[model samples]
Target: MSNAINVKRAAVASLMDQLRADVTEKKLTPQEELAILEKLKVYGRTVAGSDAIYSSEGIIFLAEVASRPDNPDSSREALRCLANALYLDRQTVQYFIDAGYVEKASEAYKSENVDDEFLLGRILFFSTTFSKDDKLLDKWVNEHHLVENNIAAIARHATAYATAASTASSQAVSMMQTMALQDTLKLLYTLTTKLPDVSTTLGPTIPHLLSLLSSIPLQSSPLQPPTHHVLDALSNIPPTTPDSQASYFPTSDPTLHVSKILKILDKAAIPATSATSSRSTTADDFDSRAASLLKLLIEIYPPSPDVVKQLIRDTLLPSEKERSLPLGSQNSATLPARLLRLASSPTTTNTRIILQTLLFVISDEDPVKFVKNVGYGHASGYLMMRGIPIPSEALEEIAAESGEEGGSGKRINPITGQYLDDELKAMEASNVKGLEGMTDEEKEQEAEKLFVLFERLNRTGVINVENPVRTAMQEGRFEEIKSDNEDSDDDDNEAGKGKGKAKA
Candidate 1:
């Protein structure tokens, strides 16, 4: 078995060497280059099954080729071989880290030129994915301008991708252009989401992203996926206060911050109210992207209750309530209603969490207020669609089994009961007093808020609203978001304050 593995590894090594030689000597023509890459990519999978492959010299050889200057096509192929080899293998990730692949790849990425956009993007993408600890990431985030560099690379590649894709008459070139755009956007998404305080990193790219987002025609197949990621990346960029403190459940401004974002959002939202609405992936993708774009827009500007309410109401109630079209038929739901329904779930697909966070914060957990203020019928419809508990008559109806009428039996939810008990216990331990001097109606009104209602209801089933900080952390939000102020005390402690006097 060991000898067989060694032979296979040798075969892979020889293949890598030949590819490198071809690139170095400029021996391979474009057609030959592509053909060889296809062979390497296919061969990579066959040999990837061997544990010995990762430790062999071939792996490093590929990394060097990938990082080599002025060979974008070959570089991409080299990177793709490694990616295919490493896909879903923990051993591959660990071996890459231990063998210093991350550092080497980072160096290559740092030295890469504009033409090496796809190659550079993959380097940053894979390196970050394989980084076992914060040592490298800290260096990039703190001292090195990785965020700045990444945005530049993305913008450069995107402009090229857009241009090539638009003008290229050849199907192959167009396909390559599509792949390039998708990869670039995905890389940007990975960078911003993984890096802390990333919104600040995207200042230069936002205008370009806004322009791209605005240009995407509704349900346009060629553009949606890449455009989708651009919006996804934007939403994932955390909102920040002037002091760099993370905004927890940030608000949306009435104007949606920039006029461009607002306009793009309007364009994207067009599909939600189209004549054909079946909630398919294309539709869902557009809806989700639109929701995420709205989230980023809202978080940038302080949210207005009126604006949110109007947004929901517009979705809930169409311009003509008594239309001739069949109910819930083609494009029955307006943009806000479609997005509201989508946002009710804390699913990652649609930036629903961001929208949910904004709404929950602004609504303050009152379902009744959300209905009365936002669009009672529409809001209720959205909640019911999600099966989220509302803690009112609407709640009973939502929780009740469909088609079962007449009995007034309360829904028995053991999980919800346990959660409420946990909340009560927490409140008692904190010695907080509430509902003592309140009437039932006042208490009901208080319970009706969207914020309170979400706490009681688990739309995503992954969140415990009473412990939002922990929930947020589990969802990969930065711990810094948990704090309103930077840990100046910790810095002071590090600098020696109360424990010992500082030397002048």
Candidate 2:
């Protein structure tokens, strides 16, 4: 037993030495570091004195490691060390915080000399695991002027740490809880306003802010205005901008700010109406803010089909009066039409929502004719079902028109051999003997054949209906079939019961 104990102790010591060496020299791969971390876990649980020595050594090693040039491989190992140290010895972590090692790590963070992933992991460990000795943080902050000298740095570090923690293992929760809400919020507020300054810096901060917004505990009294302040700031930046717009909004690159803003909105709970009167006051302000951002998006980026669809859906099927709009008047039509034109243009890719919106409009009147003339295929069925009057006169006139003298004036139906009226008129004016010899019956037969062929061509494939009429018909028929089958089953059961009773 003594021999076995000695062997285990030696193994633990060996692992600790390796961990220390790796942390100091930055020589370990992330994989090797992870192996060492696993061994530390075992040593932490099974070996005597392992926790004490590891915690002390781990802190020193992390401080040393963080000071090195940025290397993802080495930093990953450093993060593993910080995580283990925080998990194993909270008291030791406080020692580091008290001894000003935390401030040193923070300085490395600001220098942009450390790997972000490692710095994030280290800060997270410090923030969450350091004992609640306010003196430690206060002393460090006062001595280093943390809030004054490095407010931006602190915010950047906190945001990056929070975001990275969120994506890390489940251990991140405890790490996040270590932060003071007031301090964190204040830092976040400062960072949020400086988003335009740090647009390029916003990528890492966004996830962190979103996470903070999600984790913030709602309170009833002394309304938290800072929460709203952060939200408003995020909502102000447009998702898309010209390539020359800003460094953050690189012309060739997609802006992440848009996604970050969307995420913030998704995660934030609307403040309760009864919680404060200010909540009600800000409702319009929130919409106005959102609209401003959206307007910038419209101006800078062509509206996506999904976005256009959403606008149409919201406008047409608004849950509140604020969402709906009258589409009849010209002014009322402006937003929808602009969207439709953008969606309908050949130059535009992905125009499904634009087609849907136009279909809704065409379901009423002359819009159907307009869509057909423009060669849009997705809106046809809706227009047809809504009994949109296709202007036959206009169609005939268009068919009769000739482009130029040298051009073939005759517009022959591709599906049928019938010439358009314009074509026939041109032929007649040219006094073509072949057309003059045709009898009225022949002309009538040709017209009927042309109508059948054109109609079939329009329905089956040739003319692209914006929304195919057959699709609507098929859906209606399927529903009808299902209902009829259910009714038939019911009728059969009733008849069977009646026969059984009569026989009895």
Candidate 3:
């Protein structure tokens, strides 16, 4: 290890000496500088080597080299080394911050070359992540217009990549361009997450990002980096106005944008069920984010186009076949059923809340409509959790109100959200379990448990209703009984006395 360190130190020293000579003599070509930076880049991958680079003032050298516009290739390579160094050794970011790296890097961020923008954007992003200096971020956005440049970078690369992806057959070039776009997005995410107000300026990025979603195919793990990153970035910056948001979708095919996003949401949230299928917490988070973004698209102020709203409704709501089964049945085969399953899962809390909120928005946030759409079985939990009072009319089927059918003829099973015909069949099944075989004690225990649950729900003030147990007692429907523990203690005492008397 010592010998290796010695060798690395000597190599770093020689490279630094050559860099200094070339800066003064101007003899080494841009290719030579790149060669040197490539070597430095490898060395900086470890802490000891990073310390070697920092010790020899290689950061300042790299920063100065990256600042040179005439040597764009060499400058980009230099920036890559600096970015790697900052990432490998986080403490080195303070050194870069002190050297005004953000200021220097921000100037080169708008380069027409995609590679330059990618490397510099990453460097700036790293500074934001690792630097303790709070004002550094302020300087990046408030002073340097980092948000605007990133937006432009995203649009430019997205268009270029989309065009290339469509026309070019080379997967390598497409992958590189894809990576460049992803880095710009990551930087933008850091900026927006830190100062969410910056999202207001992010209006220009929406259309490009939406377009990229179609061009970029999601991997087997649907919520992988670029796709998920795009979803998340879009979520952070929905347009403030209906017209503005509407304009972001293609005028020729408005459903195109919404459809592309919805496809990803379904793919991620509703994984294919096979022997090989696996689910991860990360994917759940991604799907939740996608759901939230879809909600934003659906609930835009002043309303989206009727066609767009109808498209979302058609895509997300229960189909006729799905309506034959319970709204969130385990065997139900539909996107809405799958999403409802996710929303009610114990492990996927965020996904549950997001999907529920998405459905609620689709229902116009009316309690009655929400229940009618998803059935009282699924809607009750979300409504109670959100403290929204369940509407009395939502719990039972109503005769079709005048002119309400609008040509869509179906009678809803108010409890299951299924068609009334199927619900009747299910109710007629004799195999349905009930309390018939339970002992008296067991039935009492079950009743007590239900009473406790209602009491707790009432205490939360989530709903205003008398506890059923209290009402039952007041109505003389239940009789007071000794506590089970007290009865057990008395039995034990009698047994003990019987044993003592036998011994006497």
Candidate 4:
């Protein structure tokens, strides 16, 4: 028995040396390091020692190994160990945090390898939220003092995950993408919420955020990864703070337009998805958060008067489904068209909030311009749905004199859209451009191109744009629509518990 014990101790010593070399210096391959880790894990469970992975040096080696730039596979393995230690040994974890391991891992998280990205993000998630060394984070931010926010590390990984999710072929890849996204969001949320003063990180993070949001599917299921956190971080960020300045609307021309982002949000919130392919709960949370951000954005940057026509052109007219509808039909199916759709629906109170935003944006232009361009029916109907009173001045222009007394200035019929003859004529005149000479198939194709116009010229609804009434319809009246993927919330809660559970 004594001879057998001596042999096992010798083997353990050799394995420990290998592990130490792997962490202290880049002397071992990824495979070698993993093998050592496995051996140490098995031995450490059976025997307690001052130099084992459960000790201070063990954590130091793991943190150093995690931030390695040469071998991401090894780095990821090391990160997993550190994250486990995050919940196991607070004294060791704090020593690591104070040594700046959290920030170093954060910077390394920008790794091109998706696996490395996931692990690094997990490190940030636990370290910032669970370990939560605020002093370390503050000092780290000061050390890497950026003149501008350079969150490219996290941003690149975020964009990479989104891009990969689009082309993922296998279920494993899909799951990885899901995890990568959720982990990144969690880390970002923790940073913004816990260290709101860390503006250097958030500055470069904004553009990538917009890019990611622009790519999300509309109507995501609530079971998907809670995407709402992104919006929460954005909405909570102080706009004037230095950290907030990086995301601020450019003061100069060619700036990030309010209408531009609104259009992106419009597409994301309502993106057409195939019926068979299910949306996850995280996606639904994202949509909710996105809508909230949209509310904040609309409040800060209502569409610019200079770009009003462009907003209508890009968002309402040329979108995918809107194209198939007749120009008259297209009019009522647009962004403005949907505003009426939502406001009239009993399902949500976002209507009141959305209505006020639309009113403020369109308020800059004359109603007649909208009537002639988008058709009086669509524009007027949307105003009516929001309970805003129609302006008599604009109404007079669309309604021809009945010439009969008490004929209540000819209201457009709501169902058939019949009333705006003059506006329809004007719309058709501009619409008939290429068809001035084409015929047969040529005219057919030309007509298809003109799908950008409203569905029907004849339509009825209130024409009110002046001094609109604003109300937050969802306020106290609505609850979030629940999703079928409630298990995800349970799973996430379980994961959170893993972080806060008692140390070993």
Candidate 5:
């Protein structure tokens, strides 16, 4: 097997050397170049072939062939080969950069030919994806002014495609145009994330991004390709000033941007779950990106109209039936219920925090209303995590109003935000499997479990609290007992070892 692989590699190396020599001597014809490029393109699709190309300076050869003005067909093929090579073997990226090929490629963005534009965009996208050097990105943004010169024009061209896409059937829009737009957005997102200040100088890119977001037809999945890239790029480029933020929306429809974001969020929330597996990472990405964009818009919108707030309330907050249901029992069919479920999830931390914060904002940032609206069961953890104090008067008012009629004559259970009868039924169901049958040892084990849980919570900065079991032990609340394994346990502890079970 090894001998066969070595022979194949040798043949590939000889071919790469021949291509490099022909390109260097300017002796390769257009037809010959096309045939060699087809082979190079195939070779670049694998790691070993890409490595051979890089070692033989095949990237430089491909770039030279692609830059030949008279051989447009060969140039396109060469660009494809280079793109494949750079993508498959990221080590070729720095080599391409050091060879001054990126600047040459950027100049081609001025060409009216659509194929050249898309191919060059793909190449540039790979450069951004693979290169970690911030100096190069900074030079491209500030010194070269790539954003003003190339990126903005690319956005305009893409915007035209997106606008055309919005009105026409999906098949009518050119796939090449869509791909070019996706690559351009990916390039814009990577650059802005590295140097966010460049977003401020991105002349017409912001509107163009928004246009694409609004125009891009969501497939069976809302988080696919250009839509995902557009949202990601927009979130990283937030408005620098309050006035600038407000300027994005019209006064007549102040909630325009918020409405658009919620539409996406609504779709995203429908499928999100705390039990998401690795296969569902795309759903998680949508939730996180959409939540981030929503948070940015909410933070920037002026407080006057209250229209955006009202719109959010109508869309994301609890429905009429949900307003009366216990938060723990709320159906996940509604957006607010799904968000409430996600807000308590440990895995989706960013989505959780943003959901809680957005909920608080729509509640007028009042502790009492926040608790009253979502119930103490749902609101307490977030309030404690954020260190937002619940006023004594507010708590007292909530307690006083807990069992009120509220026009429905249904007495509310303030802790879980359920009606009194509903809470009683749930309590009865839980007690059917009560802990009364447990032995003293089992009870002690449960207490130790609680102690470990509190210790872990305190350690993680989720909450600050003393272990009640530890405090009880210190207060001499328990009698001591000896264990047969005590000596071995002590030896293990001294050796910095422990079993699967945690010590209290």
Candidate 6:
């Protein structure tokens, strides 16, 4: 009896497995598929243990099953399954759309009670896959109405889909279809006005979309309505506030949104001359725009040396006159200084420009005086080591001026020997004044001692020089003379003795 019960349980499990496979393959007849779908929906809601079965393949199967009859009710069920499947695997939904499953997907998207997840998935699928199908997009747009919630949904959809499609061929197509300059501008305006939170929530996505639109090359014609619209939209975004919007800067990736904007500007063909303007405008307008964009960039992104160097080279270098203008002028040095501070920062990639600028400022004036008086003495040591050439003409002029002065008529000492009589007297007086605090008795005693020492030296006619070795050498010379005299007497005595002996 136990073996029979086990067999019955195994048979029921096998039947359920077969039924699931049938649903996945869409092999059921329309009526049968509908009934199974209803059961699956119930299972999806209550089969507390079978949630893991809703794979991408399962959703594709269900979407296929619903499309079999092309009826509204079936389409709704198919969309729900597809939505659940997408929640599981977005790539799978994209795959289905690529395989020409878009029409069926759109049918399901039209459900009145569609969840945000389902709506978002369908919008992405449609924007990415059927980007060129403006009629379909228009139909959805018209039916959805231009309400904030709908627009927000569309914005979110555009942003999310664009992020995913960034690398796909669909990016170009999607930009061409849904993201014209005008539409992007309008969308951005609406987004910024209604959803200020977008700066934080869709931080990376908004710039990417803007970059794609910006990249489209503009024609030579006067500012078109669409061009103006895009410009206006860009202008509307508040200049990036450092505290709240710091994360919007381009990342380290080479394929960043800012790069895309640069490429777009490169492709654009601005008019050579405008009718309303008398001045011949080159690419300065674009450069100004680029600079403005970079201003926000510097505020949001940590300053990088490369970014700073590029700003100097690209923005400040070209407009030297503007950069050098007086402080209050339209083109003043303030902006350039701010940019240089950012680019020439110690942490930046290129610090040579900063060093060079400092050197130039130092060298422009009388550098010696500047170094001596301006607390730049440390810099002087560096300058000397760096072998900066002192101007030969300046050296010659200094020599010539010095030559005009008369030389001193008398010179005695190479070391402290040139004092005049009055100078020596003044030095003695100062030394005497230094002892003024001594008692009168001490002063008289010092004077009397000096007088006695000089008198004794005069009487002896001796200075009593302190060198003992020299005194000993002089005494020894005198002793040698006296001994020679004694030796002469002894020689005489010896000679007399020799004569006497000869007489005898």
Q: Residue 407 in candidate 6 has what lDDT?
A: 26
Write the residue-wise lDDT of candidate 4 on 1-504 in tens digits. Answer: 667656666776677667776545868777877777666555544333324565666677767766667766666666666666665555666767667676676556555566665676666667667666567667655664311222554466456646755876333235665566667777677677667554544645765665555445433342134345556555544454433443444456333544545654555443222243554343333334445555545434332333543553455322323322323442444664454333333333443346434434544444543443334445665555556554544533333235643223444423223443433554577775333334444533332232211112212322323211011112322112223333455434332222211111
Worst 10 residues of 4 by lDDT: 464-473
- Extract clashing residue pairs from model 6: 215-264, 305-348, 305-349, 308-343
Q: Each model's TM-score, in the order given?
A: 0.54, 0.29, 0.77, 0.45, 0.74, 0.26
Candidate achieving the largest lDDT: 3
lDDT of 4: 0.49
Query: lDDT tens string, model 2, 85-182?
Result: 55556666765665556666544433432344234434543453344755654554456443343344435544554564568644543433333333
Query: What does candidate 5's lDDT look like per residue over 400-423, in tens digits?
Result: 342553335455655676666665
**Can you write out model 6's per-residue Cα lDDT over 294-320, one digit (the tens) per residue?**
333333223323553343334322122
Q: After TM-score superposition, what is the CA distance of residue 78 in candidate 6 from its true location, in Å?
A: 27
lDDT of 1 by residue, 1-504 (tens): 777767766665665566768756978776676666667677667654334345546566666666665657777777777776666454565565566666555545544344355555555566666676777776765555566666665665556544544665333234544555565677677776666656566545665565455444334442267666777776776445342222222244433324444445544543333334445554555554566666665565443345544554343332223122222233445444444545543333555555544454445556643442234333554455565555443322122233544212333122221122334555567885445545544433343342333543454552323433223335544222122233455333222211211111
Candidate 1: residue 230 lDDT (0-100): 73
| lDDT for each residue of candidate 3 in 1-504, tens digit (9 for 90 to 100) | 888888888888888789889977999987888898888888877767445577527787788888887977777778878878877776677778888878867766877676777688788888877767667777877788777778788888677757766875555345656677778888877766677554456666777777677777656666677887787677777567554566555578867777777777677676334334465654555555555455555444225567877878887877656777888787875778877777776656456677788888888899888887788778888898888998656755552344575323667767687777666667667554334545566656666665656555666775555554555566666655555343345434332222210000
Q: After superposition, how far is residue 347 of candidate 2 from its true place, in Å?
A: 50
- Is 4 or 6 the stronger prediction by lDDT? 4
Candidate 4 lands at a TM-score of 0.45
> Cα-based RMSD of the predictions, in order?
19.2, 21.1, 8.2, 19.7, 9.2, 28.9
lDDT per prediction? Answer: 0.50, 0.42, 0.70, 0.49, 0.65, 0.38
Stretch of 10 with least lDDT, candidate 3: 495-504
Query: Model 5 — which ten-residue stretch has the worst lDDT?
Result: 494-503
